[model samples]
Target: MERDRGRYVPGGRESAHQADYLELFFDLVLVFALNGLVNRIVPALTTDDLNVRWAALFQTVVLALPLLWLWTTTGHITSRFDPRRRLIQLVVLISALGLLIMGTSLPYAFSGRGLAFALPYVLLQAGRPLLFIFTLPVGDAVRALYLRSAIWFAGSAVLWIGGALTTEWRRVVLWTSAVAVDLIGARLNWPVRGLARLPASAWAVERGRHLPERYQQLLLIALGETVLALGISYTNEPATTETTIGLLTAYLTTVLLWRVYYHRSGEMLGEALDSVRGRNNLGRITGAAHIVMVFGIVATAIGYKLVQQHALDRPFPLWVVVILGGPALFLWGRIRLERVVFDRLSRRRVVAIVALAVLMVPLAFTSALVAAIAASVVLFGVAAADARRSAGRPPEAPAPPA
Candidate 1:
């Protein structure tokens, strides 16, 4: 095959890059998909036996990994493709419909609905890149990148379909490996002998701006889930003093999450990511962190629902996982993202992560609602202290690293 060496010019710069409406609409599917996944696993958290509940939830999360990979990668696809075209918009809508079908399959994903999930997933992974390849004008670097991406997606789709054809532990083992391959391949830019690995930035100058915005928006949607879960849970039953307290604490937890990322710190991190001209490690880390961060938000949403049921009353051991584990995961992802982008540690976040971990031990003895409050309060302190400290400093203006 002759390569279009002259034809494949890199992306051109524009005044500004913002996520289009199609991108936002596409992200809406992921939010709902996560809700379905949570609905499947979280109810089991009420089980009195900690060991049983842990096993059940872990199994459910493992099953949910494919959908998370689907969500993240789909975002990457749209970020590269020109969503302005009617066909691209149609493709995105169809992808969203596929996700809805996948969401329906998630509750029984480890069992009878395996094919139900895998069929749509295989269709999206195999079909999406082809759509973009044909839609994009010939000679674009992004088109070439998608061509490389399609190869890996095709390889992963084989395992996905194979898993769906099997039963029991074999299905779980196969699908888990499939998700791992999908994630690893994307991270490596689907490296193969003879094909050059394009620096993530080479695909689009504007992508650095667009990709982080997409992730931040996804995180915002995940936070909104926490609020929605609290509202619906409270409305179905009569409110009590404890319920009110739980609601307030849940609301604060959501806000603290918002402040932690959306505040000045998030801007600083974005600039830092932009500064690194090549070797898109920031994009890779941001993509991976979004998974952990959003999963944590979903976990926290699950914890809030349980907290609503037993507000202010410590009743079960699994609440520790439902409550503390969410914040711990979110903080862990947050700290890692900062470490990569800013290359400077936030001692406050480090403390918050540590405190959340250690506090889990003592808070495990208390009510789920109490544990929820305790965890959020730790973040509250971190956000407040950081705000007070950064109030006087000028915004960071780091030069692009050589």
Candidate 2:
């Protein structure tokens, strides 16, 4: 494998690097962005106005999907290119700055900062790939892939910028349409009017560990957000018995989420990818799984904050939704990921998902604290099932096709 000047060269396993420090530095900004998202949605769950709450919830998804998409794009860049190169470093640093601006604008995205959010995002999404297109040799397959990607991003930019210039639901519709374009375009391989789809080899990951490591880092980042929110929420309040109990419940829930995540399947993604028969769709499946799990973690953080802020208050329906829904969503994502790794459905997670749904109605009448505990218990059961399955057996090797 000959090294290109700035592009990734497929190399021996020994030559491939682990995730670089700069990549981790970039993820710090993602932490702030995740926090902004959690903060953005908390108010919506607490509000009494049905229309306002529903609108804010829609806004939350509208805002969140793009941010997660941006992160996924960044991961692909590092996976496809040489992250240690100066040009790659510059792309990541600029992205961190863009994320910072996006995070700052989030609280006001629907009100006054739509452009503030849209501008940097558009520049990053549409511009970064254009940069890559010029950097690679004209005949390079990777360059061709990026060419298709840039076309899609450039087309979607119209809607993003248009949404930014508008107001209210108009903005939401345009922005949502823009995200659909970006996401669905990528899913379909970013087809253009005059171009054929890039061959599957064009999407091959040269460095196997890099993409999996980045995904794992993101999972930790999401879990880290939950820990930070729990700690901060606890420090700000009087440590009464109820608050203390709520803190413990939230902390346990966070641990259980982490536990359920890393059990056999999560720990074996790299092996699964290595063993998979085809690589083209593995990254896409894994990326979608992590996105859903991260969403769940962010929502869980918001729910715990609500518990800390109003521990004794009667749980609102929305609060209960957040409380149980987060873990349920996490389990749902985990089940998909398990199939990717093991080629098997996760009955335990399925049962947990159903259990959470059943508990939601009863939990709605209880305190947020009770709802939090029930969610944690459900997660614990999943983790326990994982432990039991692994007991007295050899470590689970990935069964994913090559």
Candidate 3:
């Protein structure tokens, strides 16, 4: 396997080790897409009928997946290429503008404006690689990878745009096909004709920091939006006791969720990724795991808003999916990450997930505040147990490349 080596350039920051300004600015733009997604879902989800709420939530997830994947794939480009380059920065700007329009159209995406949402997605995902192919110099291996990726995105775009032009159930089927194709390409690393398999030498995180840092920034955005949802909930309604307790409970839950992952889980995964820099399988597992983790955070954000809106002591039955299921999904992701990173299963973590699942039936009858608080306590238990387990182990280093 190749080591941490790069070509030298005189008088350039190409060798600089941290994220640059243009990348940070681009990250800021993507959050508009995230905020727009939650804004659309929560109101639809809060309807009085159970079946309607379920349908709304189901559709919300479907719409949000492609948006998330678009941003993730864009991140892949910025992470791999030199965004500091003049041409690369221009492409990044163009993609961000397309995404902003897509974000604004989220509420109407499934209604009348499906094509509005679809076109920007197609342009951003399919056009990005096409832009790079012509601008990047010849004989570069990374450029060849760009060609392979463009092929994947172009094929997926056909399904995406076709789905957008349809309505109702057929739209769902076609969009699913598009997402499935994209996921399969990623899962298999888009192994088309003669592109070098990656984390190419350019994409490796030498200090084991860049890749995780980018993901962590997104995680921060997720957590910040959770807190924002709590604020929005509080503002929209009267500040009575139920509202106060619900907000407090959600605030605590967000903090614990942050502690559970960022405290130990993220650092360990970053180091593990560094260990197997050029090995795509380990990196894919870790990246896929974080995607699940982000979804859990997004789910929890919606639950917090619902918690505030419910009548006191009346059951918030959907708490089963959001309050309980969110943490469960996160722990599931964490367990997968740790198994690969530490080479051992954390039994307490697994037990905590099962316990949360068992508690869901009872939680469905409880007040939202009680439900949020209960899940928070359970996560604390898992984090505590993992801390104890770590006390007897060697201080972490990336597992040496096998």
Candidate whose lDDT is highest: 2
TM-score of 1: 0.88
Would you list the rank order by lDDT, best first? 2, 1, 3
Query: lDDT values of the candidates?
Result: 0.73, 0.85, 0.72
The C-alpha RMSD of each candidate to the native structure, in angstroms, is 3.6, 2.4, 4.3
TM-score of 2: 0.95
Clashing pairs in 3: none
lDDT of 1 by residue, 1-402 (tens): 122443322233242266788777777777778777667766777776777687677767776677777776666655654555455567778888888899888878877888889999888887877765765566556666777878888998888889988986788778778888877776667776776655443223244476677778888888876777778888875698888888899899999988887665455655766777663655666666777888788889888888888786675656786688888788778876676566667688888888888887788777887898898889899889878987889865643333
Which residues of candidate 1, in runs, are more than 4 Å off?
Answer: 1-16, 49-51, 134-141, 193-208, 268-270, 312-315, 398-402
Task: In angstroms, give how far residue 388 of model 3 lies from its true place.
Answer: 3.8
lDDT of predicted model 2: 0.85
User: Of models 2 and 3, which has the larger lDDT?
Assistant: 2
Q: Model 1, residue 384: what's the lDDT?
A: 93
lDDT of 3 by residue, 1-402 (tens): 111224321122345445667767766666667777777877776677887778777777777787778767766665665556665677678877877888888888877888888898888877877765665555555566667778998998898888888886777788778888888876665777655664443223334355666777777777887887789879998999888988887888888777788656666666666666464555566677777887888888877777788735555467566877888888888777776576667677789889988998877776777777788889889777767767878876645235
Worst 10 contiguous positions by lDDT, candidate 2: 8-17
